[model samples]
Target: MDPLVLGGIVAISTILVLFSGVSVGLGLLIVSTGFLLVFDGLRSLELLPEILFGKLDNFALLSIPMFIIMGASIASTRAGADLYEALERWLTRVPGGLVISNLGACALFAAMSGSSPATCAAIGKMGIPEMRKRGYPDGVAAGSIAAGGTLGILIPPSVTMIVYGIATETSIGRLFLAGVFPGLLLVSLFMAWSLYSTWKYGDRALLASTTYTWKQKFEILPRVLPFLAIIVGVLYAMYGGIATPSETAAVGALLCLLIAMIIYKLWNPKDLWLVLRDSTKESVMILFIIAAAGVFSYMLSSLYITQSIAEWIATLDVNRWVLMGAVNVFLLIAGFFLPPVAVILMAAPILLPIITTAGFDPIWFAVILTINMEIGLISPPVGLNLYVINGIAPDISLKTILKGSLPFVACMVIAILLLCVFPGIATWLPDAVMGQAL
Candidate 1:
């Protein structure tokens, strides 16, 4: 069979299986196996074990589980609640203060966690209740949390960045450094939108402001200081050549465990079991997806599908910027239906060659791709972050969550545009730190 014809069959079958509620890992595995059977017969089955091992052999991939455990440890403790409460005390005087505080908390959590759904859950659990008590609009409150949660992937220590770096052979440390500024930029844009929306359309009846004494504010500092220390320690170790990204992740996870057990006094045996159990499940799920994507990507390469797509793209007469825009649009559309990791796994292999051939920096493009994926997290229908927020605050309908997330989605678009126009926004820090674009 022609490779293109086979490609279409594989794509359609995979999509149908996914929409039919099969897990992504299983769906990809089944589709790839079917293609292998059709194309190479029984002999292809022998390659499965080798393919899975090769895919999972990377040292950098070890970081995924450690980072996940680090986040889970924080989540299992009082740290998430304390972080939100502290930010709320500090930001309550600002317009749309509660929402701003929620965004702030999400940013902080994203810095530490590297997972969007985890960030959404940690902040939403605390912020939504407070917003309800303050009479804030459900849509805005839920939307702020949903949209802000996306920072989990754009910010440093992002699991998505790690996956992207591994998939593209880009530097994971540099990728981490590159995300810092864009993450801050998104945080600013989200907060600005919150302030503007509150001033322009928020219910004044629900916008009650609070005052905190100097002593009171200082008291909350202890609650967040340890987490800050972990962030600082991890980054410094990676940048100062004290540890690799994987090593830094291990250290960070260990620190989080100690903090939960010692400082927070929150780690009982059952709590410990829950954190380990949850982290193991999440880590295993991600790895399984990676393994399955490996098989699918290999099949695409073997069939020459990716190369044909790239060559076809290369022949297009459109300007590189136009191509970039189209890629962003495609990714945005894909994001609405796919998770960031899945998008990266499927799109990066095909698009990276086309993008690099167009003469764009791979590091800068990674940031852009990540931001686009970030928007998808809160996008309507299958956006994971939206579902996470809705699950947390079930009374807030999915419609309300989607409505609230729209503004933040706009904020993300603006951020992407800014990054495109001034690629330095994403590249400058990493360049300065690494002394070259990684």
Candidate 2:
């Protein structure tokens, strides 16, 4: 059989299994095994262990589990709720204050968690009720949390960035640094949209000032500030060359556990067991997907399908901007149908070389890809964040939620344009930080 035919079979089978509701890891593994049998007979079996083990054995990958542990432990301890509450107290004075605070809390939590669903879950559990209580529309409240949650992968320490960095051989630390400005930019833009929504509704979301004295405001800081401090300290030390990314993650996890024990008092033996168990489960699921993706990626390379696709893309005579716009549209449409990990796994291999050959910045493209995935977090059918938020806000209608999310989606479109116009916003931090190290 032709290798391209074998490649197409493998890709189609994987998607079929996924569409049949099999776990992504199982789907990829089964599909890859089927392809290996048909395409190369039993010889492909010899290649499996090396590729799978090689993919899973990276030291940098250890950071994934540690970060998951940190996020779970923090959520389990309920420290994130305190952070949201404090932000609410401060921001509730603004028109559409609940929406603004939801976005703000999502940004802060995203900085710490770096997983979109986790961000939505963490903030949604707290922000939903608070927003609903403040007379905010249920759909608007749900939409804000869901949209804001996507900030997780756009921000630093993001799991998506780490995966992309590993796949592309880009510096993970530099990728983390590169995400900072764009993440904040998205947050600001989301907040602006929320304010605009309030204005359109004639400030219906405006909450009367319920006085919280300065002393009272100061008192709530003790509950949530330590988690914030851990993230800030870890990033600062990493930027200052005081620690490697993995080391910083380990230290941050340890510090977060300690804070949970001391401040939240929720890190007892049982709680610790649960946190570790949950972390292990989440880590295994993600690593399995990565391993399977690696195999799929390997098969693509072996079949020369990636090269063929890249060569085909190179034949297009379009300029860089047009190429980028085309890429963006493709990703956005695919994102509506695909989970983020799957999207990255499949598209990254096909798109990477094409963009590089066109003299485009891969780091900026990574950010652009992430922004497109951010849009997917709110899009229909398989939007993980939308489902997570829906589960949290059971009372909200899907139509209302989708309507409320439209403005933030528009904001993401604008944000993508800004990144396109000034690729340096994504590239500058990585270059400056890495250059200084040199």
Candidate 3:
């Protein structure tokens, strides 16, 4: 088969496998292997071992498990819950206070967990009950938690940023710094939206007036200081050039382990075992996807499909913004049903070249892609955030979750436009920090 024909077949196979409810890792492997055999004969299949091993050999990739361990430790220890309560108390005087606090808590949790599901799960458990008890509407409560949970990808130390940086060979520390401003921008947007919504609909009454003495308020600080300290410590280490991103992750993991074991006393034998087990499982799944995607990508290149597509794209005499708009639309549609990781792996190889060819910065483009994927987490039908929130709030139907998410999804759309129009939102921090370093 010709390269273009092989690419076409692989693409179709991948879509079919996903639509058939097969696992993404297995689906990509099957499609890639099938293409290899059809195009290059059985001998090509022998490279699978080397391919898989090479993917795992990456030192940068080691950060995935370390981050997962830190996140799992925080989750199991209930530290996120404590931080949410602290934030709630601090922000409760404002309108839509619970929702605002929820977003704040999620942001803080995002810095710790570097994951959407864990952030959602941690905050949802505490936020939902508090909101419901305070008479907040079910839709609003669920929506806020869902929206806030998506923060895990936007904030610093984000697992998605790490993954993207690794895949593209971008500076991970720079990517982390690059995300800070945009992530905070999204958080601010969410807060503004939540306040407006609450004011329009009328907020629930404040919880019982229990005045905490200054001493009592100060007591809550001890619980949350670790979460904040880790963020500062890692960024400082990276900024000082004392540690690479991977090495920083190892240090972060060690600190988390000690905190769980000594400070929190949450790291019993069973808990440690569970964290290790879960981290290993999640890491394997991620590695499998990366390897399979790598193989499929190699197959596409061998087939010359990317070149043909690039040539066709080059022929179009359209404005750069129009071309970018089209790519965003493609990602948004794909996000409705596909995982962000899959979309990134498959689409980046194709769209990235077009973006560079159109004179856009890859650093900014990566941020744009990150925003698009974050939106995907909340989009309906197959939204991972929706399923996560639904799993936590079982009484709420998927319809309710989707309905609640629509407004925030709108907010995300607006956020994307803001980033597009103002690329500095993504680039400024990286430039400032890296400039100082130089």
Candidate 4:
């Protein structure tokens, strides 16, 4: 069979296997092995050990688990509640500020945890009930956090960005820098919509009391500022060249563990065990997927399918913008089914070359891809954040969650459009800080 035709079959078979409830890592492994067995014989199987070892030997990949540990340590504690409370105390003076606070908490926690579902769950647990008490409708209450939770992957220390950086051989530091402005831009857009929706729909009679004193507000800052400092420190360590990505992750994880233990009194053996267990599980899962993707990639390359696809893409005579649009649409669709990390590992190898060859910066395109992943977190079928919100507030149906998330999705779409017109939102920070990648 033609390599292109075989590649098409392999793609469909992988999707079917995944849709049939196989775990992503195992599914990819099975797909690659089965396809290679039939077409390339046992010789391809001989390369399996080398492929797995080569993929897992990456030292930069250590950051995934370290960051996961960092996020999990904070997540398994009261940090989320304290962060939400801290933001609420400060922002409550403004009208419709509770919703804004929830979104703000999401962004901050996202910076801290780098996991979308965790961000949604952490903030939504308290933030949702608090909003309902303020007479915000179910949709508004659930929508803000669900949409805001998507920020986790867009903010620095993001696992998705890390995966993309490693897979595409882009600078992890630059990728971290690339996300800063776009993440803030999305936060601002989400907040604006929050204020508008709350004022238009939330009950004035039940608005949160704004009568708290300066002393009360000041007291909460001590608990929240340290974690905020950690966020800044992680960004600084990565961008300032003080540490490599893995070293920064190691230090950041250590700080997060220390802070959670001190402020939250999470020093109990059971609590520590929970943090270890959760982070280990999540980290292993992500790492396994990476290894499987490596095998899958090897099969494609060895079979010459990757070269065929690239040649086909090169032959296309369309304008770069048109090519970009098609890629974005495909990414948006891929994100609907796969998590951000999976999409990056599966597609970035193919997409990055096309993007750079067409005169677009891979760094800028990283932001665009992250935003699309943000949209997927709230989209139907496998919208992880939406389900997390639903879990926290069982009364709110998935339909309602989707309704609330739609505007934020629109906000994401607008951000992408803006990035298209002016790619600097993604590129400028990295270039200024790192002296531009050659």
Candidate 5:
């Protein structure tokens, strides 16, 4: 059978199964196994154990569970509430200040937690209700949290970055450094949009302003100081060449636990157990998907499907930029259906070769692709962040959350275009800080 035809059949069947509510790991496993059995005979089944073990044995992937535990630990504390209070008190005078503060809080939390759902759930629990009480529009309140949550994976310490780094054999440290500026840029863009939306569309009569005394401002510092220390410590250790990404994640997790137990005094045996349990569940789910993706990716490679597709793409008469645009479009559409990790796992094998062939830097393209995934978190149908917001604020319909996210989605699009036009936005910080691509 033609590889393309077989690839098409595999792709369509996988999508149908996934849409039918099959877990991503199982869906990928079933599709890949079926394809391998039919094409390569029963001997191909033997590769499953090797692929699963080899893929999960990496030291770098250790950071996913550590980072997840760190995030979950912090979420168990009052850190998120304190951070939200601090930002809200300082920013309330500005237009859409509350919403902007939500964005800020999300960014801060994203620095610590590299998962979008964690960021959304942590901040949304506090930000959404407060915004609603303050008479902010439901869509605006929900949208801000949902959109801001996407920052989790784009910021450093991102689990998706770990997966992408391992998948492409790129340096995880470089990917972390590359994300710093783009993450900040997206924060700025989201904040700008929030300000504009509130000023233009918000009901001024209901958008009450507040002032805080210097003493009050100083008092809020204690709530945020511990988190800041953890962020600085982790980044310093990683960038100062003191530790690898896994080491940094371990240190961060320990610090987060210490803060929760000692500083916040919010820790208990029960809560600690819950955090561990939740982290284990999430880590297992992600790692399982990765293991399945490994088998599927191997199957694609074994059949020369990815290479044939890349070669076919290379034969096109179109300019490289046009091809890049097409890739972006495909990713945008895929984001609506697939989660970021799945997208990176499935697409990177096929697209990275084509992208590098066009003389683009792989690190720069990783940043660009990360930004695209950021947008996907807020997009419809399978937008994880949107559902996260709805789960937090059940009264706000998914449609309203989706509506509110449209503006922020536009901000992400603008950010992506800017990154495309001047690749420096994503690369400069990594180059200046690391002195070379890691």
Candidate 6:
């Protein structure tokens, strides 16, 4: 049997299982097990324990749970509202400022939490109502929050980036550095759209209805400043080589949890339990997927499929840019179904060799991949952020949320093109800060 044929069948089967509503981790395991039995016989099972256990016994992976804990603690509190309100108070005077503020808050909070759903839920709860009350179009208001939330995976300390680093053996800290500029670039593009939307409807007055005095704005800062400081501290620790990813994540999670407890009076056992429970659940899901993907990758390699595919791609006569365009298209399609972490774990190993072979930096490709997944968070049929925002604003139809998010999706696409033309947007900061990725 042709290895490529088997690879194609495996890919299709995995997608079908996911579409049938199987969870990514489990769906992957089922496909992997089925193939190992059919193709490699039962004796291939001996390889499982080593690959799965070895894949997860890393110190760096510890950061995933800590980051999840940090994000969960913040999400289970009022930091989301406080962050949104603080920015709203400051940006209220500008036209379309309310929506712009939400985008800014999402960017800032994403830096802290590193989970798209958490970012969407936390900010969308407050931002949606306020925007709707102020007569911002429902689609636009809901869309802005949903779109802003996708920044979570593209920002530092991101679970997705960590997964990518682990899967591809790239530098986690350098990948985090790589994400910084692209993250900011997306935020700027989103904000630019918000500003344009306001100007397009200038007569309608897209400004926030609420107003705050300088004293009021200053007062809100004290509550939000600590979280902001955590963001700065985590970035500093990682980029300055002051701490390992695990160290910053652990300390940052503890600090975030304590601060949320003290400031929000959320130290009660239930809230604490909720954060811990949620963190454990999400972290376990990710770690399990990592283990499962390791098996799936091994099967592909053992079958000579990955090597064959990479060889086939290398033999293509098309321009590398054309190859990238096709890769982006394929990734965008995959993102529509799978979570970013799952996508990274399953696909990064397969694609990284091909990307580097084409004379592209793996770090720059990570940013592009992250952005594609960002678009998936809002794309219809299965976009998670779309549902998160819909949960917050149940009155807004899914179609409306998708509608509003379209422009921001275009913003992400534009960011990708910019990166292609000038790869430095993703590579420069990492190179400067980390001395070029090896």
Estimate the TM-score of every prediction.
0.96, 0.95, 0.95, 0.98, 0.96, 0.98
In model 1, the runs with Cα more than 4 Å from the true position are 202-207
- TM-score for model 2? 0.95
Worst 10 residues of 4 by lDDT: 202-211
> Candidate 1 has which clashing residue pairs, if any?
none
lDDT by residue for model 2 over 180-214, one digit each (tens)?
Answer: 99998999998888887778766654644455678
- List per-candidate RMSD values in Å: 1.7, 1.9, 2.0, 1.2, 1.6, 1.2
Clash-forming residue pairs, model 3: 3-303
Candidate 3 residues 1-438, lDDT tens each? 555565666677789988998888788778877777777788888887787667667788878778888788888777888888887777777788888889999999998888898999999999987887777778888888898888898788877787777667678888898888888988998889888888877765454323456676678988789767987898899888898888888899888888878768864798789988988898787877787777767666666877777767888999989999999998888888887777777786777778889988778887888888888888877788889888988998878888887788888889889988898898888888786323
Better of 1 and 3 by TM-score: 1
lDDT of 4 by residue, 1-438 (tens): 898898899889989999999899999899989988998999889999899879989889999999999999989988999999988888886777888888889999999999999999999999998888777887888888999999999899889988988788888888988999999999999888877886787447234556678998899899989988988988787777798899999999999999989989988999999898988999899999999999988888888888888788889999989999999999999999998888898887678778888889998999999999989999989999999999999999999989988999999999999999988888988888888788
lDDT of 4 at 427: 90
Instruction: Report the lDDT tens digits of candidate 5 across residue range 99-187.
Output: 88889999998888787888899899999998888878899899989989999998988899999999999988889889988999999
The candidate 5 region of ten consecutive residues with least summed lDDT is 201-210
User: Higher-TM-score candidate among 1 and 2?
Assistant: 1
Worst 10 residues of 3 by lDDT: 204-213
Which window of 10 residues has the lowest lDDT sum in candidate 1?
Answer: 201-210
Please identify which of the two predictions, 1 or 6, would achieve the higher lDDT against the true structure.
Answer: 6
TM-score of 1: 0.96
CA-lDDT, candidates in order = 0.87, 0.83, 0.82, 0.89, 0.88, 0.89
